[model samples]
Target: MGSLWSQFSTPNPMFTEDDVAPQDSKVFRITGGYSGIGFELAKMLYRKKGRVYIAGRSDQKGQQGIKDIQHSASAEAFKPKEAKLHVLWNNVGVCQPPVGSASKQVIELQLATNCLGPFLFIRYQLLDHAH
Candidate 1:
């Protein structure tokens, strides 16, 4: 619990951008990787040669994040193949519309987006990336 709280704090003591280096041939899929901490982490991965996949619901925001990473990565010396950004369109909404206000389809979509998406991403994506 304490550790979890620290993650929300400023200058979170989790993973730092400097902790990992260019992976070159590796692919990374960050579930909420299009903004905030995810965006910053993606930048770090980009610098380290990791092929980053900014997985999020907002296509526009995710593309913008990719552009930001590309712009920063361009300034650094990197190989051609490592320059492209891959985006996985995974919707991850926190909640559905209040109670009976939403249709069954909407409720299901919300549940899938918020819960199933992250779970599948973590289970399958991480397993796939395992060496």
Candidate 2:
């Protein structure tokens, strides 16, 4: 078996502004973006003038985060065109048994939320709106 440290491997290096060209009104979607690293990442993209759409199953929390970012942007005098909601963050996560329980019956809950939801969101929402 692999060492336990492998489970906690460091993430890939962060990209600098110089490394990545600034997007022109690209839709940025993040799931589970209401809190934690996803929220912080959305904020960073917003500050960099990207349209950020943070998505969460909880509407209250998701809207709150959006308002907080908008408030911060207004305080910083960033124009709406410069920073707006474009991408939808699919940050939601869940865990279930490999096979669903006889009563609970949630075979695809985790996959649908973590995988298919984001895929469909990108394909449907972003693609439909893309120029």
Candidate 3:
């Protein structure tokens, strides 16, 4: 196992405006982006004029988060032209399993959620949109 102490003490990687720069024409889909780190990243990208899609398991939560993010993003004298939507539904669904005391079902769910579902979405929907 890695040193837990070292993990906590390690400095965050430094960045400048150049490093955090965004492209106006890129599409962003941030999984779990309705809160925490994902929210912050979405705000930054959206503020730079990138279209952001928030992906998560809960429809109610995701819509709420998207509104909050876009509202916050548009605060700097620029208004958003449209509410972002229409790309969140997927052919497959992923489940977030509880940590510790894992069951076979939970294990399978986490694997699908954390891995397989994203792969399928990217391979199908995203690629189709890219071209």
Candidate 4:
């Protein structure tokens, strides 16, 4: 009952973009950032001077998102390979894929997108950045 009531309650956010410190040297990677909430977050980070990378399955959409973010923030692009990631947002997800749909590795499409993909990305990032 409390959970249902909270859903309708207009509560103020405890933290917002205004609370974030400048991210002039931070690096961020957001999956599924070509659209929706991820896109907005990328924009916010970019506006705060963070180096943002938007990743998606569709290269075209990702490029468009980058362009839009750059236009909005009037920021220049930096080479992502030169910096280690300060944050990785595993925001990519899929819902209710058709039955029997499989990823390239033969796992269910939903599982591949929501679980395995993030897991693998985290692992790779950790290993790559390990000194």
Question: How many residue pairs clash in each candidate at the backbone level?
Answer: 3, 16, 0, 0
Using lDDT, give the best candidate's number.
Answer: 4
Candidate 1 vs candidate 3, lDDT winner? 1
1-131: candidate 3 lDDT, tens digit per residue: 35687697875657743476654656556777777777777777778777777767689988888788768766333234433333343323335545553435554666666567688667875666666
The full ranking of all candidates by TM-score, starting with the best, is 4, 3, 2, 1
Candidate 4: list runs displaced more than 4 Å. Answer: 1-9, 96-101, 122-131
Off by over 4 Å in 1: 1-15, 75-104, 108-111, 119-131
Candidate 4 pairs with clashing backbones: none
- The ten-residue window of minimal lDDT in model 4 covers 74-83
How many Å off is the CA of 35 in candidate 2? 1.5
lDDT digits (tens) for residues 15-45 of candidate 4: 9999989998899889998899999999999
Which lDDT tens digits does candidate 1 get at residues 35-91? 877788778877887777777768999888888888888534334343333544343
After superposing candidate 3, which stretches have Cα over 4 Å from the reference?
1-13, 16-19, 75-107, 128-131
RMSD of each: 6.9, 5.9, 6.7, 2.8
Local accuracy by lDDT, each model: 0.66, 0.65, 0.63, 0.86
